[model samples]
Target: MAADALPYPLRLQGSGIVLREWQPDDLEDLVTMLDEPAIARWTPMPSPFDIEAGLAYLKRAQTGRLSGRRIQLAITVDGGEPLGEMLLFGVTGDRREAELGYLVGARHRRRGLATAALTLLSGYACGTLGLGRLLLRIDPCNTASTSVARRCGYRLTGEPPIAQAGPYGPTSLDTWEYVEGLPGPRRQRLRNVAARRYGRRP
Candidate 1:
């Protein structure tokens, strides 16, 4: 999608986190966090993170937003810190399914930021976007994220025995799948409030 096609603005919170679009200024922070050994260990990030890679990622995320392929947010606490990212991707033709992906900077782990962001974002997907299901592919060894998924109401479906490479990977990693979102009035209300708070049309 073209940059012109994206109309939604950044969404902010009183807690100092702003669910916002990618900016040129965020490249430095992205490089810093993505280069962390622990962050790179579980995630499919480039091993030797650099300015060029960060810029490229920003561009792709923006384009994905424009095309509706994904709705991505830069997770920042104390506002504008780019500590991590959360994404709703794999939107299909019917708009019935999408997958969730999240990565918090090693520094930001264990702070409930992931849970808060996931809850907020999941509501947005179901309420404003009207998606029926959200899937999560989690690394089995990452117990923290696994617990976060459960806390956010995702139910485990099963686990894959070995690693699975994504389209961009040379190797595969073992994964556990979980899903959330079915239709209901409670979900509608959550979406309504989120839409109003985030300046999205109800």
Candidate 2:
């Protein structure tokens, strides 16, 4: 789809949460949340996140939207302070496929924000964007994330052949697939494509 056709500053609302584009004022919160050891360990973020890195990320978030390749949104409550972030990246227009990634702040964990954000984004992707499928890669040991995926209707498709690279190094990862329709050859194709892209067994 064209860049203008897609929602750049997409805004999604849930029970008590809203997913909207990032703002300049969010830098401090973003850096603080991403600087946590847990966040660094789980995500591909800079080990020692600083203002510079945060600024760069903010820039990329804007550019990514304009490029029509990604949509990065901040998860907040009532359009207030940011609680976390959600992204729909690596979008393939013809195939109607994209990858979903999210991280909730340490202070916001265990409050169902992650699941709520996922559900909102899933609806926007399948309903607004007309995406056929969405993919998620999580470390197998991350029980919280695994649970969130399951709760969001993402089916376990097994581990990938290769591992996902983190700040420290690479580690084994699990692949999950979520789609609105029944699983078929198209779902399998998405699995294979994701596996290959992530250096996993295809």
Specify the highest-lDDT model's number. Answer: 2
Least lDDT summed over 10 consecutive residues: which range in candidate 2? 193-202
TM-score of 2: 0.85
**Cα RMSD for predicted model 2:** 5.4
lDDT of 1 at 52: 86
lDDT of 1 at 69: 62
Candidate 2 segments exceeding 4 Å error = 1-5, 183-202
User: Could you tell me the TM-score of candidate 1?
Assistant: 0.75
- C-alpha TM-scores of all predictions: 0.75, 0.85
Q: Residue 13: error of model 1 in Å? A: 4.1
lDDT of each: 0.68, 0.80
CA RMSD of each candidate after superposition:
8.9, 5.4
Predicted candidate 1 versus true structure: per-residue lDDT over 1-202, tens digit per residue: 4432323554645334666777778889888888776656666777677888888888988778767567788887756688788887887777777788888888888888888788777777777777777777766566687678767876543334456543245443333233344446655554454344333432
Candidate with the greatest TM-score versus the true structure: 2
Pairs in steric clash, model 1:
162-174, 163-172, 163-173, 163-174, 164-172, 164-173, 165-172
